[model samples]
Target: MFSKLFKSQSALRRFYSTATQNLTEKQEPKTYYKITLLRSAIALPKRYKDTLVTLGIHRRMQTVFHPHKPDIAGKILRVKELVQVENVPASAVRTKTEQRWERRPDPGFEVVGTWKNKRWLLDEEGI
Candidate 1:
């Protein structure tokens, strides 16, 4: 009975290990850091707040991107509890303007002009 239990547990462990290996191997190497401040550093130690500033995070729930470098990783570790970090590819990087543009609501239709101006333009075109 003891031998049978050990064999089954060992088989299950092997399966899980291979499954984890496959998951890690299938992913591309991440080149960028996507860090978001989840919790506020308010009332925390000055060093924690300073680390957040060094990471360019000044507000809660704000996200910033940095290259995947050891220095940045160390800084992230310093405030890990107050922030969330994700690995991202270089192509996923965006500037502030691009990020803001993405948040804007899309207008349903294109507005060439009002009917009066559109009619005037149409009449003047001799069409």
Candidate 2:
């Protein structure tokens, strides 16, 4: 019985170590980049925002990667009036991208629903 228990314990230890290794392996190394959102697409016509969106940027602070090319550099310069470009590591860029993707939806819907239901019920009861 003791030998069986020892074997089981060893199995458990191996399983735990394998699970930890799997977790570590799934983690992506971070990528960072210098980013700038060159256009005030918000102020420009919707076409500009659509163009920026096509380029993988949406909101004002949104950023996308472009290998340093003359065309990209030129676009950055044109948008320089609106955006502040900076050099950053690929890892930092990856972290920021992950963070933006992981962001939760706004709580406004739940808040409005609760408030409307509570207010309606209270009014109906003459409270």
Best by TM-score: 1
TM-score, model 2 to reference:
0.39
Runs of candidate 1 with Cα error greater than 4 angstroms are 1-29, 114-126
In model 1, what is the error at residue 30, expressed in angstroms? 2.1
TM-scores of the candidates are 0.67, 0.39
Write one digit per residue (lDDT tens) for candidate 1, span 10-98. 99999999999888756656799999999999998899999999989899888899998899999999998988999887778877688
RMSD of 1: 12.7
**Tens digits of per-residue lDDT for model 2 on 1-127?**
9999999999999999999987765553323335557446666767656556545666666666655567666666645566666654344455455767768567575432256469766767789
RMSD of each: 12.7, 11.1
The number of the candidate with the highest lDDT is: 1
